[model samples]
Target: MIRINAIPLIASRTFLPRLPRTVRQYTSYNVAVAGLTESQEEFRNVVHDFAQKEIAPRAEEIDKTNHLPEDIFPKLGEMGLLGVTVPEKWGGLGLGYLEHTIAMEELSRASASIALSYGAHSNLMVNQLNRWGTDDQKSEYLPKLLSGEHIGSLAMSEPNAGSDVVSMRTKAELKGGKWILNGSKCWITNAPVSSTFLIYAKSDTSVAPSKGMTAFLVERGFKGFEVGEKLDKFGMRGSPTAELFFDNVEIPEENVLGQVGKGASVLMSGLDLERLVLSGGPLGIMQAALNLTLDYTHERKQFGKKIGTFQLIQGKLADVYTKLSASRSYVYAVARACDAGKVSRQDCAGAILYSSDRAVEVAMEAQQCLGGNGYINDYPAGRLLRDSRLYTVGAGTQEIRRMLIGRGFNELATAEDIRAYNDATINGGVRGLFYGIGLSLPTHYILNSRVTAYRNLPSPAKAFGFVMLIVPCMTITAEKSGEAFTRSQYEGVAKRELDKEAQIEHERWQSLSSVQKLGDWARRHKYGLVGASWVGSLGVAWALVNRNKHQTTSQKVVQARMWAQGLTVGLLMASALLTGFDSSKTEDPRTPHEDHTWRAILESDPHLNEEERKRLHEIKRAVVDRKEQLVKEASNSVSK
Candidate 1:
């Protein structure tokens, strides 16, 4: 005698309910076609269970005590997660990027602060050594990290050099045969508890700091290696952060990580992986936020009825879903590139940028829906909100991402810039320009102007740069479209994708529009201002470079080489700006409400699907059958 058709039934048919499957699909599995292997899945289950049972129960207590993840380093090491990419010969799992990213994303979902501590220990610090360290260094250090015998910490940030990396002041002087390092590293995670450190210092005081920088492997037991006072932080309390003081630490030439003048190279090369891990860790955090918010909205009732039934709440829920899904898709695109052996600095930067930015957005929405209760620290959302704040500012600020993006404008049409606006910067005709507008500008008007300018023709080298400029268009495609890349768009058996996109667009816009448009006039005020600036910068750069008239065939070939280099620089910068933004704010404000509401239950508890669920049930039955039989063996063994 029960009927569930209870709410706004008549009006339901007027609105599309199911989300567009393309966005839905991309949102869920952003990594690419490869799902987890059975073993990988088992690893996921064990880790998930461990997190839920151990970490979740104590998360509040641990967070309150500012319990750093140092004590937990041994546990993650035991789980074979740290050496995800190192060769097993060096005591590592040698797993690919997908698996590593998955582990980061999943564990972080429970408590991002803990995940950060553990991830930095196992991933950023250890993996960097594995990738670039000499055989002696690996033999000496990798095993310690893998066995959890030694905790590795990175000492990159200083009192200065947070974003401007080249302006470091730590000095390392060469003393006859041994190098004496004398400086202090600040804001170092795992510093107080760390047994090993990857320290970057300037070897030659006179040369450019970034260029003369050298990397050294320092151990806690070293004579001059001492831990200073621990630095208290707002989030990531699950990891011990401290100032590391080094006073005339004598390190032999043997301890050098790479070549003397190659510290910058080592740090830069390792940074790509660091960014990848950092980006991957937040995927799980967002997923958890979604699940928690879903539970609260559904369970909490108002006015003698489930509040979730109200259109206003449902609209909020829908918006949360769409934003999370879009961010996931963006993360997955970057993951795909990284997993496919495309772990360039640009690729990782893009991944970090997109994931971090999305994380802030999703986390904020979760906080908002919790209403007054969302502000309370007792709830995970409160902690997540505080924890997520550091993403944009810690590694690189959003402003830095934007500025870096500015460098790539010569290539990526997706970025907006000031120069693109006619008299925008000078005459104050417009403030900013965006790329989507430039690309979508009326073709006749835009191209006619370009064609008129094209009359000058320029030189072969400059003309080739034009081709490089068009290459980013090659990246445009549906988030989940399965197609070979074209120079400017997608091409393949994409009939299904094309059809799904229309339905997807309608739903996506609907969900996004529900959040109340701030002001349409403000949005329409400038179109593609950033992109226009990018185009203008490229134009100016082309003008400044002297045109070479050398018509030799070899010289023509050299220009081709130049084009490739130019493409790489622009693409990497574009990817960084477009893909690598971590947060929308330098510091995001969050307040947890004192009370909250919830729906009965949630999704992304990461339960098995129907078939898998059935299989799990069957396995449980089989385990029960074996339990009684196993008691006899236990008794016999005990008797023996």
Candidate 2:
């Protein structure tokens, strides 16, 4: 007997499609993108408070005066934010890339311009300098760059070299113990105010300036140095940018950054961070825009009704949510990869390339939602819109970033690479979790939060934080039961015969830590994530109508959808518990891998060639198998 009920799915259809757009988007990615670490979260709160109190309050005035954010950096220095990614021993926070990006998100909410100011120091110049600078140079410069006392800036683009570094004309020639530097760099951020600059200049006769480029630490008092005319822009006025003239300035012999010719690494890698940071800048802006638009639409009324009542406005809000949420997850994933150490240049380029393009789309949409108010200076969306244009321009243009990202993908992706890539994923899945979550505070907290959020979810719209909880719950229960039943269905002799081939020595058995098993199982059934969010949202809504009077009909509809979603999610969890190869025997509650019960067969295992390729096939098989079994089980359970 097949039991099919159209009633809940019907209600889901009504409610899930109508959720407040931004709310749904954010909820979808809470776990996928992850969030700030406990330490970083504290820093984020500190930054938020600081931004609100110091920067947000003064943003209007700063924009009006087109002033440089010279005053803000002192406090940022005092707070240890400017050097968050700089090594701690070197007079900086040493929090790393993810934390640094999180800080950017919070600070930029106050002022895109000010955020860029901090970015110019850490992302553009300081990090590169740390990687490429000489020992003497590091001891002398790192402390200052990390300190608020010495500002770091990059002088690479000239009037002619905006997106084309190969076209740079600035030249430096050997002159005994000094290198004679000539030509000028334009659009240099923190110019005039910045104390130190990573000045890139052509050093050889290689015809192509890019191949001959050399990076030098040109100090503020360098001879024959000047800040050119300060130019005004459409937005982000609080941070200043200008041209830097190098009129045959002399760099000391020891000032050679990285063996004179290795400047390409300095340029590409530093710019990768620049673009990544640039890509991340808009997360805050988009989030702020979402918050602002939500407040504005809900507060403002037309025809004696809130504008939020109209489907048109809801539609606009949904678009903003979708774009921002998608972009945020992608950025976080990429940023986390970089933070994990040695992110490929191609990966970094790909992420930022996608990020900036999305920023433009979302920011513009947010502006549209504000209507006439969005155009006026009184509202923030308009300013953010103009300010965000630099995201597409700075750190390299969107067009060029696309070219770089595309070229990278062209090289990395191929049919021959598929098996190797798959194996890597499998290996990374178990071990990556061990290392990434084992040491990472943010990743640990994020998963914990997702589980907590799932447990606390009472309605559809609010219950959307994590998708991992569901698939594993259902898949494990069904798979284990089926296998057990299949084993039971055979007669004693048949079952005994079957067990031999399928099973090996207990000592040979490899098991996943409960968390790893859950993650692996969940990854297999990832498609259920979209199903739960969309369908579950509707279930929660409808469940609300039948179950709770406090909620409006629409809200109730959403609750019903969520309730349905909760079932699927819970089932996946059960599935994981039942079918995992190794039973969890740990008593530690702090984290899943506490006693190291999880073991994966990677290079040592004969079953899998490569971790990535093995995991890909395993995941595909498990998930598809789970789905087919789930439908049958759901039918049987309902019929009974």
Candidate 3:
């Protein structure tokens, strides 16, 4: 008799309902990643303490007065934050983008305006100069900028060109030993306060906008260069943004930032870091919002109960918390990748885009949670909303950023490209580990090929691979498992966790409910599971037989057979209770319109005459009238 329960030990439902909304002190909430080095933790603590003690107190005054905190820069400089991304030889901290992002996040948590100005100075000007500036240029400007004696800003956006920065009107012409710059930059952060400005202008107007642009390092005192009126606006008030007028400004030949006609390269290269670093601003705002909401919910009462105790309030809190956690994870991961010099362009756009949008939503929700107080200026909720709104439009508009991300992914998504990426970057860590273990040559090659093949498979195939890999082991152990967990029960377990590590483990266990459900669904289809097992076993056996034909050495043949047997047994046991892939199933279209609207309706009934159209219109009208009537009734019922 066939061993029908070959993998009964593993088949159990993994997926389940989410935890219930509950209010409690998550005091052990440490948001830092578990693998943080000692130095990173120390640095984070230092920055957090600095933000809380030095920056937080001044945040209100800064917002109220709408004044740039010139005094704060010196303290930041003294702490070596100004040059965090710069090198030691260049009067910088010699740290990486990760550290820079940490500083940005901490500072922004206290005040986003301050953080915005800091980013414009540090990442936009100082870091770019460090990367592309000549030795003499660094020697002349690095020390003063790093020490906070000089402030710097970047100028690219112009009156008519914000998202289309390459089409800026600023024009620079090479003259005798200097360049004549004409035109003005609007909405320039740190413009009035900056001693140095890195401006982009068209060097060759005849060519394409991107190719014609050139970068120039213009000093504040340069002739014809003037700071214009400051723009008073909503939120980020203290950041001090203004127009920059360059009327025949004479820039020295040595001030040419990068190669003429290659300013686009300089500009595009710096944007990744700018986007990554600026993301911290939103992350900080989210954190502040979360803190404010938590405090407000716990203290404020309504309907004879603390609002925090209400499930609705708790649900809002949970959403904000989840968003903040996810944003933090993405931002930090991207920052680490930047530090590792392996940044993906799409991910850079994605991080800022995702975090920026979520930050605005979370801030608004925080404001809503506070009710009347959140609406008024007494709390920082209004300010947070205003500041967060700027992100959706700044750096790059959300629309443009979305296009960039989609375009980038489309360009890179190819079989060969995917395989190369896996070999060069994605699998580097694992490959190194295997190399360290001194695996046999054939084993190394085979494993790498397997991993590459797995990665290159289509999405559906990958899903199958995951199920085939996981479902068997779980199915075999299902007989030993206990009853399912309720949502409230899961939350209780999560809350009682003593530390971040324990909390993460509890979360992982809780998330298995959905997986368990999937496994159960698979178990319901017995024939499919058995067939998959046989197919997998036969495939493995056939592969081993073919390998034996090529193997001259007896040792190699033995090893191959052993590998085949192990894999076959593993597959058979796993697949005994796992579901098979159904080729007949069609993928759901990834579009918003389920029915394709009126076009689909018209296409389906193309033979209909004018009479049919008239009838359909009448039916639609009746439906609308019915909907309005129902809505009115619902409103009346609610009011009563």
Candidate 3 ranges beyond 4 A from true positions: 1-35, 412-640
Instruction: List model 1 lDDT by residue over 536-619, tens digit each.
Output: 544554443336563444443334434433443353234323322223321211112111010001111122344653443344
Clashes of 2: 51
Q: What are the models' TM-scores?
A: 0.59, 0.61, 0.61
Mind giving the per-residue lDDT tens digits that candidate 2 earns over 1-640? 2111211222113422344454324332353145644455566678778887788767767887888766677778888887777777777787777777878887887788888888998778888877787779989888767767888898888888777777788888998879999998888888858899998888896656556778888898988998887779788788788888888899997888887866776887787777676666887777767776676566556777878789999998898788777777777777877774546666677666666666667778777876765666666777788777887777777788778867875653456555554554455445534443344445445655777864465655333422344434444544554444435434544776557635643223445666665555554555576366546655554645576655455444434544555565455445434544333452322223312222221212233334654454455345446555655655554455
Per-residue lDDT tens digits of candidate 3, residues 1-640? 1111121111111101111232224422364442354467678778888887788777877888989877888888998999998988787889888888888888888899999999999999999999889999999998988888899999999889998888788899988878999999988999879999999999999998889989999999988989998778799988999999988999988988889899999999999889999999999899888877876676565776778999999999999989988898898899888875566788889999999999999999999997866777657888889899988998999998899888985663467645554444424444444443443344445654778865566878655644454444443333222112223334655676446556664664577566544544444453374456545654665566566554445444334444444564354335322323222332322222322222223322323565765554454344345545655654554455
Question: Candidate 1's C-alpha lDDT?
Answer: 0.64
Give, for candidate 2, the lowest lDDT window spanning 10 residues: 3-12
lDDT, candidate 2, at 361: 75
Worst 10 residues of 3 by lDDT: 7-16
CA shift of 537, model 2, Å: 53
Candidate 2 residue runs with Cα over 4 Å from true position:
1-37, 206-210, 412-640
Q: What's each prediction's clash count?
A: 41, 51, 25
